[model samples]
Target chain A: MEKTGADGFDGFVTARWSALFHLARLLCGGDRHRAEDLLQEALVKLWFAWPKVADEAPEAYVRKIMGRAAARSARRRWWGERPVDRLPELAQTGDMSAAVAERSRLETALAQLTPRQRAAVVLRYYQDLSEKQVAAVLGVPVGTARSHASRGVARLRQILADVIDPVG
Target chain B: MDHFEQELARMMRDSQEYIPFASEQRERLREGVRARRRLRAATVAGGSVLLVAGLTAGLFLLPKGPAVDRPQGPLTRPGTSSSSSPAPSTSSPAVSPTQSHAPGTPTGTGTTGGSSPPSTFPSGSVDPTTFPPNPPATTATAPATSTVAQGTRTARPPVSSPPAGSHSSG
Candidate 1:
């Protein structure tokens, strides 16, 4: 039997779901629900464009959509972190707990930066993209992209000072 | 990249949890695609309706051309007086009154002849040569004269000279 468009698309989405979800989570500043929404929206778009982009770079297409949408929504409305006395999730025990705590701290710090800066930083460091690639994804100039990443990293250095100790 | 950058990258990679593509997610994606397709179809249909309606309105709103000025009756022979019939000179007294009242006769000729006093008739009638010369002048001036004279002339009856009235009333 011939492999249909839907089958191909489903397979692609299944294969890349975890990586894309993580990218979305970071893009949305670690809000799981918002990350899911973002990913779902990108997937819907990918389904429509699957015929054209399936053979080429479907993953890149989804990443571009999510990055732009995340930045645009952030600029339109303030999705500020709500301060609470107690933590939402109970602290887990053992080796994984420290990693989870570190991840939480990173997300909290990421949420503090402007949307563009956060997007640039996530694309630069987490995705390991060059400044030009980051610029292409964000639809901005290289200098602008470079500035955003540098400023974002400088801010993160202040926010995560204790978590990431200075090199001896 | 620096030590801090390396650590951040590593932490980002390590923070990702293994998430399977669930049946629930696939269903949701299918539903989302269906909804978007419906919305797009509705938008296209609405735009088409609006475009057709606008074109129809524009077609109706265009200004109409000036009304045609058609001649009211059958084309008359050129150079023949509208008031004068083809009937011979002997039948003049009998035909004159009927021709004057004919619906298609030029209003200017009827009113101009009717407004003249009965005394003016003997000179034109006695010299019969005057009658022949009058046709050309009457035909030329008939159309140029105003029809406003017709309404005023209708109030007073045409004074029929003794000779013509006697011949007709006989």
Candidate 2:
């Protein structure tokens, strides 16, 4: 029914702000600045689409917008081509706890993955979504999404081998 | 769940506190919506101006009708005098044969219906027998008076009383 004006939108934003913001952060691999930019862009898009949204759940529509924004930003950043080498192994040694070392390694490794791979990993493991759900979020086939997750996990394991599993 | 997946989920949960939606976040969203509206308006304005300019240019650039059809020379009104003569020549008994059949002259008497009279006289043989005794004074004074005055000058007035058959017509 013709939801006019920005009042309903403002209320929706206030109600779902935390969840959407967290989703944006996850999609952008915890880059707070990029995540905020992505969220703002998505909100602007939603503002334009607010009238035509009809009876669909606003959160799902906005979540889809956020995912698309993340993908487009990735394309723009990489010039539509994924980088050949996202993470180059660095040779360094330090004495730290396994948890801190693994966390730091994950953050650095996450930043190095292509946008789609990072998004797939975040949606699958971090957000606890099934492969099908992950594929829907990333707009890829289930097989492609599984490949992205496997490849992303393999890269992270390789990069953090010294910290996550020093013996093996 | 694999040990690596468990660790990843735990780390993501820990990082959840990093990005909270506060007043500043809402402000940024409001600003974003405003900027988006402004951009849409500017795009519409630009498109409208381009459309108007295109139509105006198209109107001016189209080819006009052929140039050959336009009327040339001065237009004559219905009641104005013609040939520079103040009055009509009703009293002259002897009409020059060439004047009656001049190629471009009009045959009617209306002010505007007739074509313009010939400005220059035709150079041809003159007939001495057709000279009228009382030629209109205004006719001789017309701008093309040279030919008429010359034609009259060559005619000897003494031949006015010549015998009807004695006049040799050229």
Candidate 3:
């Protein structure tokens, strides 16, 4: 008797699918498969609460879910002794070689930061939440959130120091 | 208002990527919901059957509904009530309310053998558990506003709308 999931919510999902996919893709460092999975998990949770989000801006709710998904993906692992949350091990596959190569470079750099760091950076930068709102989404103190943005940007600057030298 | 805040805002605008896939994903959300509904229906039906069986047995065995329900003169006589109560005493703890209500009884909660007087509770109101879930303590804390949203709960994690058709027996 619980209508937690929306009836015909998938229809709404179909309309927003492209935008949701891209949001996931950006947070995932443009990895298409992981982006699709993250987008699906988030939309599932959203669909479960579809009636509530129906009145609100669906895009913002989806974005919050996407941030949570991206944070979770950044915590996965691989082969033993050395910790490898960042996936340098996987083989690259795609038709566009140049774009794939650049995206790979960005993925590695983004992976170097912890999930929250990357989430803070991605949300504040790509998703464009104010620091206070970012804190609300991440469920951390504003001061702690501000530090994540600062340290995340600082880390990204160091990693991309060679290519985008505006920091130097 | 602040320079660093503005700078951070500017940095965000620099990296915005939008990738779209509209058709493939939404179909999965619908399937997940259908699976959940089937599970809930199975649970409710199973519980209803168990409840009906319990009431039928209670009606057959214990004919006098309660000590209070039927008047006392028939029971107060020597052997009449004692003869009827034998099987219930063997069945469960609550069967011997008559044996425990004897004059000059030392303890009140006859089965539990507690020092607390039976008179501590008014004639019918005995146990806290028998008291409705919201006792005086919670009765005050319960939603008091006349305009309180119907079935809709306040916005918080533990708060949620009462199930669509759920009516409180109270």
Give the top-scoring candidate (TM-score). 1
Best by lDDT: 1
Count of steric clashes across candidates, in order: 0, 0, 4
- In angstroms, how far off is A148's CA in candidate 2? 2.2
Candidate 2 lDDT tens digits, A88-135: 453353776655455545666776676778777877886688998878
Q: Residue by residue across A1-168, what tens digits does model 1's lDDT show?
A: 125998999899999999999999998878898899999999999988998999899999999999888877655544665434333553463656787888887887777777788889899988889999999999999999999989988988887788899897
How well does candidate 3 score on lDDT at residue A93?
60
Q: In candidate 1 chain B, what residue range of length 10 has the lowest lDDT sum?
A: B146-155
DockQ of 1: 0.72
Q: In CAPRI terms, where does candidate 3 land?
A: incorrect
lDDT by residue (B59-139, candidate 2, tens digit) is 776545445566697766454445644223321223343453233331222112212322211222132223443235535
- Which is the leading candidate under DockQ? 1
Ranking by lDDT: 1, 2, 3
Better of 1 and 2 by DockQ: 1
Reference-based lDDT, residue B15, model 2? 52
Reference-based lDDT, residue B32, model 1:
94
Model 1 chain A: ten consecutive residues of lowest lDDT: A82-91
